[model samples]
Target: MIVLDFVGVGLFAATGALSASRKQLDIIGFVFLAAVAGVGGGTIRDLILGVGIFWVLEPVYIVVCGGTAAVIYFTAHLLESRYRWLLWLDAVALAAYCVFGAYKGLLVTGSPVVAVVVGTLTGTLGGILRDALANEPSILLRREIYVTAALLGALAFVLSDAIGLPQPFSACAGFVVAIVIRGSALALGLPLPTYRSRPGREHGAIR
Candidate 1:
């Protein structure tokens, strides 16, 4: 499970750098983004529980963030297409973190609400931090259903637990909810609603 976390850590750092790169941010921006993206969720969790941060004892956290930033800095041109694959990759990482968070929360705190909230933070804080750094509109802040999707996925996983499903199967079901939500968003261009636009200011109104 730590291995999976590392993979997600690396991927999310990579994703953050990709977002930074797309915004044409500098190297400092990349490192900052990576650092924030790497530790954002853990930081939030620790803070909420009134515990000291987790990464302080784990140098691997710094190494991963720094290494991911370096890779992005030197290989920016090679990954110009990152934006194209960002959504799917983000979904994959999101699913991994959600399962891991829920598992840990349930094991440690044994509270379903804690499990769900931690799972959400674990799944989303990195992207939220990334958006904050980029000054790009957050996927969460927009009129989209980003956090809603994650919460529903977590709910599904919790339901699976109540039904006595295998942990792995439950995790997969939760992951599927996230993937389906994200994929459908991608395929159908789903987004939040907005007020009416003037005739000349029309922007493909959905409602």
Candidate 2:
């Protein structure tokens, strides 16, 4: 349901704002980052689907994002590194949001393949926008296993569904697959497989 999507969105907002806080950004910066990270995916989905933009159509979405932002503004430091802080939570949020977006694409648009793409877009665009807006490089530029893994997991869900998996079971499996893939990446320091750099470009910085 959309409520679950909003919950995942809220968690993401909190984590983004928390990250901004760790960087010593101002309260307004944290809130703005939270909103960007929260709404970015939904906006992409709406735009792709020609659905008149979800947040514009629903004030609940904005309210949920804003509320999470405010909470994070005050409680950011509550999540210390001792708890593994934001990373683990963000991973979980990513998994849930992926499933949520895929569900929307399937239900709203009735296309499993498109659903997978939408899921990946929904789960990742926010993080990309967040990083770029903060004057940091996009996560897509790193040799890190990130949104591509999400897309793969989402597509796997579509495959499972095509093979007759029930909606609930498929969603659960997809969510777990994403989390495992991402968690393994984090735990094992999995880097994205890279090719040789172009003729004029430098490489091996992270290597």
Candidate 3:
């Protein structure tokens, strides 16, 4: 769990730094965005669960986020496509965070439904915040399977645990489910169907 938390924080922080890079922001911006993207979701989860925030307790997570930002700031220009890197890194982080968040939720509440919701939020909220702050297109606005992937991954973990699976195995199962779904969406352009109003419908007209 500790390892997953660190990995997810670092990767998400890197994505935040990449967003800063795209915006041509300064080092301070990189650090700020990275820290927010790294800890935003988990902070919300801990707050909702009435637990001590993870970073507030350890502090290493913030250090990791800052370090990740510094690294990306120095090397991001070398990449031919920073957006591609951000997408893939965010996908992996989302996978890991979903499992970590769900595990934490289960520990606190022992409720599968809460676990799933918290896991999904943990996986996606940081990126959502990052994009909003960066003035980029929100991932939630994309017609892809981003949030759905996280939700299904969390559900997978809870279901696997309920079926008496080992903790590590269940975590792996959730991570795999999330990454596979997200990766496929990235690679194959899989998208969710969007709602469309009927052509003959008038705006704001009641049925």
Candidate 4:
């Protein structure tokens, strides 16, 4: 679990740095964005669970974020498409975080519902914060299977554990489910159906 957390944080930090690169931000900005994107979701999850923030408890996570920023700062320009890198990295982080976040929530709260919610939040919030900070389109606003993928990942983990699956297996299953869904969305341009009002009833009177 610790390894999973570190992997997710590092990838999220990379996405943050990539966003900063797109904006041509300075090193300080890169670090700032990386820190937020790396720890934002976990921080919220810890607070909601009434536990110490993971990165605050172990400052190495912050160092990881900083190191990722520095590396991307030097290498981001080499990428032919930073946006593509950001999307794929964020997808991987989302998958890892969703499973781990659900695991944490189930450990701390013993509620599958809360686990699912926390998992989704943990998976998506970091990228949301990063995009907002970078003045990019919010992932939540997209029609793609972003939040749904996270939610399903969390559900998969919780369900697998409930059925007596080993923790490691459960986590892996969840990650696979999430990544497959998100990757399909990215590669196939798959989108969720959107609301469409009737032609003349777009502004129907409210009750």
Candidate 5:
């Protein structure tokens, strides 16, 4: 699980650097963005779960993000397709972290619902923070199939674990589900339905 968390940190750090690049930020900005996007979700999760901060306890994760930012800063010109790369990389991190979060949630509490919520938060919170800091349109605001993917993936992990599946296998299953769903959304423009307020209801009176 620790290894998986580090992998997620690196992947998310790259996405954060990509986000900073899109805004024409400087080297410091890149590092800041990478650091936040890499561990923001996990930090929040730890806080909510009343545990020690993961990266604070293991400073190597911060080093990984810093190194990733430096690399991205130096190689910026080579990434003509940075946005696409960021999207895919973020998706991978999201899925991986979702499984990890679910696992941790199960450890902290026996409630499957809470575990699923934690999974969703673990998958999307970092991206949310990145988008907010960058002043970009967030995935949560769009009807794109983002959180739904996380939810299903988390649910899958929790259910699989509950049914006595091997831990690693269960995590893999959840990760695959999230990545496939998110990838399909990216490739096919698949989206969840958006609510449309009725004309009469807009004024708080039913027709």
Candidate 6:
């Protein structure tokens, strides 16, 4: 589980590095953004849950994030299409983090609802920080089904756990659901509907 968490951190760090590159940042900036993106979500989750921060408890995770950033800093240019790869990598990280967060939440709270919320936060908070630091619009605020995908994945994990599935199986179910939903959105351009004001009807409901 620790290794899996680190893998998610690495993936997120890569995306962060790429985002920094897009903004023409130096290596220091790249590493800083990468570390932030890698651990922001998990740090937030741990704080909210009143659990000790994972990376602080286990410094290896921080090393993984830093090492990942350094690697991406050096090799980012070699990647033919950074944005496309970053999207897919971010999806994978989201799925992994969602499952990890829910699993931890279950151990702590034993409530499916809490687990799902924590999982969703685990999946998205890092990306939100990444975007903010990069001066990019947050994916969470976009009309696309980003948060919905995380929610579905977390829900699946909780449901599976509630049904007596093994830990590994439940986690896998969550990860797969998240990846499929996110990948579908990326490939098919799926988006949630937005509210539109009707020319005359908008004024009738409030007063």
Q: Please give, for residues 54-118, the per-residue lDDT of candidate 5 as tens digits.
A: 88888989999999999999997797798888888988898888888888888998789989999
Residue-by-residue lDDT tens digits, candidate 3, 45-136: 99988999999999989999999999999999899999999999999999999989999999999999999999999999999999999999
Give the clashing pairs for model 1: none
Q: TM-scores of the models, in the given order?
A: 0.81, 0.84, 0.94, 0.94, 0.92, 0.91
- Which stretches in model 5 have alpha-carbon errors above 4 Å? 196-207
lDDT of 4 at 143: 69
lDDT of 2 by residue, 1-207 (tens): 555577668877876786677678887777778888888877888888777887787777778777787887777666657124566666777788887788778778888889999989887887777777766666677665889767876776777777899877887788888889988887887887667675443566545
lDDT of each: 0.75, 0.76, 0.94, 0.93, 0.88, 0.87
Give per-residue CA lDDT, model 6, range 134-196, as digits (tens): 998887776668988888999999999899998888888988999999989988888866565
Q: How close is candidate 4 to the true structure, as a TM-score?
A: 0.94
Off by over 4 Å in 3: 198-207
Per-residue C-alpha lDDT of model 1 across residues 46-162, encoded as one tens digit per residue: 677666676886778878888888888888787547775565666777766766666667767778898888878888888888888788778676555577566767777877887
* Model 6: how far residue 11 lies from native, Å: 0.6
Task: Write down the RMSD of candidate 2 (Cα, Å).
Answer: 3.7
Off by over 4 Å in 1: 192-207
Instruction: Give the Cα-based TM-score of candidate 2 against the true structure.
Output: 0.84
Model 6 root-mean-square deviation: 3.6
The alpha-carbon deviation from the true structure for residue 169 of candidate 4, after best TM-score superposition, in angstroms, is 0.6
